[model samples]
Target: MKHDIVIVGGGVPGLTLALALAQSTSLSVAVLEARDCVRLFKRDARVSAITQASKRIFKKLGVWSAIHAQAIQSFTRIECWDEAGNEIDFHCETLAMSALGYIVENQAIQFVLQEALQSYCTAQIFYSTKLIALHEKEDAIMLSTDTGQVFHAKLVVAADGAMSFVRERAQIILDKKDYNEEAIVATITTTAMHEQIARQCFLKTGPVALLPLSDSYRTSLVWTLPTAEAKQYMDLKPDDFCKALTCVFSKRFSEVVVVEGRQSFRLCKQQAQQCVKPRIALLGDALHTVHPLAGQGMNMGLLDAAALFEIIHTAIAHHRDFGSHAVLRRYARWRKADNFPMSVGIDWIKQLFAANTPVISLVRVSGLQILNRFPTIKNYFARYAVGERNGLPKLAQ
Candidate 1:
């Protein structure tokens, strides 16, 4: 069988990309998911901090209304402070918006995207199917699935995770940095009302972010720390874990209760040397993985998808081969240029906070104080976080 595009992964970015293309054009899109249908439809425990730009993309795809209604939590303010109380505050009112960003469950996004895809005739989701072999020819790309089926496509996309099978088979090299840290994620109940605000505290270990959830007093926590320490935290009893968490940010809330079980994953900073080659392209974590200090990982991946969709629109308008080197190279140039600096900047911030020397700590505190005093600087950073800028894709704009 043949398709216009074959996506290797059925994750959010891949499903979103297929939905975007299917809604606009008559592209025959097939998503090869390795998991069974039951597993693919199961609710995910993790939630992603979706930026305004990504929300706009979802809106354009006509999936935002359903996702927003399902369980999206909007945070209007962000308060980030160091351990010594030096803080920088960003408010949506200062930027003339209703929300800084949104907290969306990964399962909610996938379910919405999947439902939307079902409405389109051009999209197909093949469950329990995995791409075992790929062959790129002069015209179309060929793929062999675990089910012993062969499919051909003009373009292939790797929306798989950071350890992308397609990216590895395509021979794309990645630049990687081991953070030597693990992020523990879970939902917790706090004594204080979050009041539609997201708060983060910088500690010698790493940053702890309490993102607002639909429940007033409950928040989703993403705490980063050393791997060894993270293992210890994971081993603690639920009540003891809550006590330990309360001790870390004792000033913010009176009591902390772990309403959900804990989940831990190692953090790393990685970027592909190139995002595309011939008929192959990478999006989301498959292309780049950034430190989650700013909660930009999923947003960045959505932006990558948006950018590629825009490029494909132009290619089709001009009757150019969408999978040709000329087309893929343009995507690579646009995305790599946008993703490289952001990845590096996030790594720098992670390192800056990781340093515990007395002089560095003093400097970090002073910098936060100064940044807080300057509204202009703070607003600029806020705008960046919201994905508002010139030259962005039409959806993001």
Candidate 2:
């Protein structure tokens, strides 16, 4: 197979990349996936509490209808508290046009994205086609698949994920380490219905969040705890887990005596030594994978796709090839600016709450109090989560 571009990876970022890039060059683009097909892609139940900025990108891609149909709208409220159940912060009433953020199940999102990508454009999806080896030349890169077929493309975009095959073969270095915490994620039915409020309680060991879902009677829980503690909790029966949850959540969640679809994953922080190199580039988790504390993992990837799409066009208009070093550098520059801050922010939050010292606790809890009091400050941060800059890229705004 031959294409102007070969995108490796078919997850959220890769599909979004296909949609974003199709708008740029008239080049033939092919997305290669290892999956045999896009069936009920049972992805992680973890949902993205996405910002409005990210929603705008979907709107531009004509993906909003699918998401809206499948997603729950979160407006009006977000609450945070300390380990002692002291309210740290709250967001409400007015913070731009909507509330703080939205939460969408990852699997449901993948299903919708697959549908939109298929219907929105003419790009072909190559399922179950895994990249086995790569050889690059001045004009093109040759990709050999597991099935013996070979592919040729002028540039390869890797959104393959944290353990990216292309990124490794290309020899891009990364800095990574585990956060030493495991997050137990699940959906639970609450005794008192959620009135559209998102709440988080940060413990000395970690943080537990209850994000609003579609049914006012149910909520999503993401509990980050010490790895050992997480393992013990996961080993508990459903009933026991629900009882334990009540102890942790208390009255805020009302009754929480039931939960479904329980799952757990270890937390990690990984960043690339560099985001781009010559004809190859990384996007999404391939570039940087942060902790799930903020639920912005996919949003950051969407931003990367948006920026790269625009940069490719600008490069083309200037008569520069899309794979040129300068062109790739432009993508890197835009991504690095945001990626670094986000990595730091997520890590800082992890460290802040992970501490047990009383003084640290006072500072952290008091800070949340101050943040809760200021809607102006909250709105500004909220805008960042949604990818809304006053000067957001056309695809994102």
Candidate 3:
């Protein structure tokens, strides 16, 4: 098969980039997905806290409507409290915004991106194909799959996720860090209806965040705990698990029961040492992994895809070399500037919130009070959450 661009992952970032780039007259694209097709409504225990920037990108890619119904409008505010669940509040109104951001399910977003890609006649979609080798010639990149099929393209995108084969084959190094913790995520039914407010409770163990779901009464939990404890929680029966959770999380939202299945993911900080490698480029989890505390991992990946598309599209429009070092370097520069800070910020949050030091607790609590006291910083965050901040591609902006 022949294409201008070949994306190795059929996940959200790969599919969205294919759709976004297909809009440009200069490129023809294809997405190679290794996973079997997933059906809608299958419980995706993972939920994402999407920023305003992510929403705008969806609108531009023409999938916002498909995702809107399933998305929970999170206009109220997000509150973080100490272990006691008291002595604090942070309101969205402080920034003069109706909602800070929105909560969306992982499955729905994947479905929407898949459906959106289907609308692009210029893009080819492939499933169950895994890249096995990449041979970069003078003018094009060749990709071989495990099935022995080969593909040639002007550029190969490495959206193949955290352990990207493309990045590995190209010999790209990653700056990686691990918190020695695991995040246990599950969907649950809450006795108390969530009033559109997101909650993150910082405990000595780790941070537990409750995200709103489509239904008023349901919410999702991402609880980061020590690796051993997370495994223990995963092995517990539902009744015992809920009881143990309530002991730490409390009865603030009664009737808490874990969904049908639960999963634990190791928490880590990893960023690609290089974002662009000759004919190959990296995006999304392939490039960086932030702590899930802020839920910005996917958002950062999508932003990378958007920025790359802009750079490639501009070069193609001017009839310049789109795959040259000059063209690819621009994308690397843009992504590093934004992804670097997010990686650091998330690490800071992990260290800041997980400590049991009395002084650290005092500082974190007082920090919240001060944060709420200043409308300027609050508004800055509010704008950034909504995608008004900066570094977005033209289409995303």
> Number of the top candidate by lDDT?
1
Q: Write the per-residue lDDT of candidate 1 for residues 96-128, one digit (tens) a residue.
A: 998999999888888888888888889999988
Per-candidate TM-scores read 0.97, 0.94, 0.94
Instruction: Specify the highest-TM-score model's number.
Output: 1
Residue 371 error for model 2, in Å?
Answer: 2.6
Q: For candidate 2, lDDT tens digit of each residue in 45-139?
A: 57888777777888888777787777655745777777676674445456546566677777676677777667535477889887889997888
Per-residue CA lDDT of candidate 3, range 1-397, in tens? 8998899898888888888887766478888888876656465788788777788888887788888876655747777776655444446676566667788887888887777667678897888887778898878899898889999988889998888888899889988887789999887776777888787888888888888888787788898898998998999998888887777556455667655458899988888888887778899999888889888888888899899888888888888777777789999999888877777877876777777688977777777677677867766765665567666787668
Candidate 1 residue pairs that clash: none
- lDDT (C-alpha, whole model) for all candidates: 0.86, 0.80, 0.80
Model 2: number of clashes? 2
